[model samples]
Target: MDEQQRLAYWRANTALIRNLLIVWALVSLVFSILLVETLNKIQFFGVPFGFWMAQQGSILVFVVLIFIYAFQMDKLDQKYNNKK
Candidate 1:
């Protein structure tokens, strides 16, 4: 790829990472921690929503995010013609 293409690819990659990290932080920090008191009032599978999020939901979301990141990166690679 040319220098311009290289810059664009990096930019897209960085944006993807930023967006994913934002989602991770919101799930891990906001709903799980900051809003726990309020969220505890809600139910999820017979458990408190906040507790479920803190104990399992966050981990599940993180794992899902990993797959999403991989999938998105693959698309980005294809878009940038980075395949070997």
Candidate 2:
């Protein structure tokens, strides 16, 4: 790829990463800690939502985010002609 194409690809990749990181942080930190009191007022599958998030929900969200990131990055790669 040309220099411009490389730069574009890098920028796209960085943006994708940034978005995914934000989601991860929100799930792992905000849902599990900052919003725990409010979330605990609700129940999910018989467990407090905040407790679930602290124990398992964040993990599940992280896994899902990984998949989403991979899928989006694949599209970005194709868009930038950087696919392997």
Candidate 3:
């Protein structure tokens, strides 16, 4: 690819990373402080929704997000290198 294509690819990659980070932050905030009472109204197999989110859901999402970001970025890197 030419320089213009490379720049576009990088920009797209950066946007994906930023969007994922925002989603991660929102999930963290929801579990940590924002929607505790509303979340508590919904039960997950006898567990309080808020408590479950705080204790496990957020962590799981974060871990999954990390893997997803890593995998996507790795693919982008491989593509860029292959073009050379």
TM-score for all predictions?
0.97, 0.91, 0.80
**By lDDT: ranked, best first:** 1, 2, 3
Model 2 ranges off by over 4 Å: none
Give Cα-based local distance difference scores for all models: 0.96, 0.91, 0.85
Model 1: weakest 10-residue lDDT segment is 75-84
Q: State, as a TM-score between 0 and 1, how close model 3 is to the true structure.
A: 0.80
Candidate 1, residues 2-77, lDDT tens digits: the string is 9999999999999999999999999999999999999999999999999999999999999999999999999999
- lDDT top scorer: 1
In candidate 1, position 22 carries an lDDT of: 99
Q: Is candidate 2 or candidate 3 better by TM-score?
A: 2
The backbone clash count of each candidate, in order, is: 0, 0, 0
